[model samples]
Target: MARNVNYGALICCLFVTSIFLGIFVLVPVLVALFAYPSSPSFSIDLFDNQALNMTRTDDSPTNLTIHFDLKLKNENKAIGLHYPDPQIITFSYFPNVSLLTILAEYKLDGFYQGNGKTRHVQGMVVATGFPTVLEGTDMIAFWVDLVGSYKYKKDRTKMHRVELGCLVGIDYISSKKMQSGFIGLVEPGLDSKLKKKPSPDYGYP
Candidate 1:
């Protein structure tokens, strides 16, 4: 009789443990899977790569104009996206192995995007006082960083910010001109630290 009582107590303890585990672990997992929104896709297109060139002379600064299109897509099925005004787009060059130099920067205007929709933002950035010398290199690499804040349609109370970055190498046929054509867009890597950072005050509720 005592053996049977011990067995029944053990079964009760196991059942209670299972209930607590489901409430604490399984419930949150299900909520996260259904509530979290998907990340958007980002890409950049260089319109005139030939514009990327260096000017000769020390007194006269080089003015490098880069015309490009930034493509942003909302991949979420039901949730819309609200981008804040004046998105920051930076163009940088790696003059050496470790150093990164900013050549140009442009403020892109923000807009709303429906679910599964893509936006093509056309803009240009002129780099003045450019210090890089591209005379000896056949190809030069540039890094693009995009930083912006956004909010989902369902969750307007919380704002989420993200940074997308990519690198592209331009091949120069001459010191003054780059190979003519549209440079293929490279998919940027999303910053992993995006979730940990605090959201900015956008005055949105």
Candidate 2:
């Protein structure tokens, strides 16, 4: 009789342990396997100092041609991104504390980005109508907005739209024609709803 009782207790303990493992360990692993990956990262690079200088010919408006490299990195460990063709990029300038003026729009050819990989896309845009406030200023700040749709390589049937934005400011000395590199912070997250305007904390006054 004592031997049978001991066997019954052992069976009960095993059942309880199995339940605990299922609730604590197996459940999370399964949830992670099906969840979406982390959002991708983005940055911009301005290699040429002259890219920011405005030029004019005859009666033509002040032409500001900017050459930049847009960098996109997939942060996922196992998932990849499929960006559709013709991504739209908008360049704008601030005429005042509350006014944003559109300068130019450029379209970039899209491609695939593998997990844990980065891609540098070369882009250029010719913008006119620079605000008088930029004249003789030591620093100029502008807004860069990117809008595109992408699909997960793991699930290509569904396409998701993403909007990314950042503010780039450069300092220059008009006497020497020298300029500092571009610096800005790309907003976090993967959609337009997650984007926030630059505040005083980000050097936007």
Candidate 3:
């Protein structure tokens, strides 16, 4: 005689297992997909500058700064962020000839954000180095950029990642005020020659 196979019991066991997996694993992934975190927003004000101006005095090496207010907002009501050590923040200088490669100018600082709250982080990236002047001119033109990458946990449940980037530009390195009173070597009637080639600025204010 063949033993009876309990098909009803096997079906019930499968249904129970599926329910547990759905509740424990699949639900969290779905929530993370919908309630994802937003990229960090930044609004910065340079210390002792009227606007986003880059300046160097006659004697001092060019002081490059990346300090500004950095903010992160958690869009997920259930997600919280954990910022561990070894956060990488860099401020680098791009030459006029090539803006791709850079000489690192300053260090960027990183921080953490809470659920439904905006985290405010502040620091100053000061780089003191002699700037190279452009050929046939007493002025220097270079670009400054800031990049930050951070690792965080989702609702303290799992890990996720995000990044932040910004660009800064040095219009001119002269203390001499133009006739318009801007911080550059903009002399009257010589505007065409003094003007450098146009470059894309990312509104890094």
TM-score of each: 0.61, 0.62, 0.46
lDDT digits (tens) for residues 1-205 of candidate 3: 9999899999999999999988999788877755655543443332323354445457654544444444445555555555553344344333444333233334434456666676644666555443454454544443322344444454445443433344343446553312221111111212122322221232232
Residue-level error in angstroms, candidate 2, position 191: 15
TM-score of 1: 0.61
Candidate 2 colliding pairs: none
**Could you tell me the lDDT of residue 31 within candidate 1?**
67
lDDT (10s digit) by residue, model 1, range 123-191: 787764354533456656566777778888774457777677776666544544243333433334322
What residue runs in model 3 are displaced by over 4 Å at the alpha carbon? 1-57, 100-112, 130-158, 173-205
Q: Kindly give the stretch of ten consecutive residues in candidate 1 with the minimal lDDT sum.
A: 193-202
Output the TM-score of candidate 3: 0.46
Best by TM-score: 2
TM-score winner, 1 or 2:
2
Write the candidate numbers in order of decreasing lDDT.
1, 2, 3
1-205, model 2: which lDDT tens digit per residue? 4444687889999999999988999777656644756667766665444434333347745556777777777877678788876678776655444556566677878788887798877877776555334444554556677778777787435877767777655544442222244433365422243233342223544
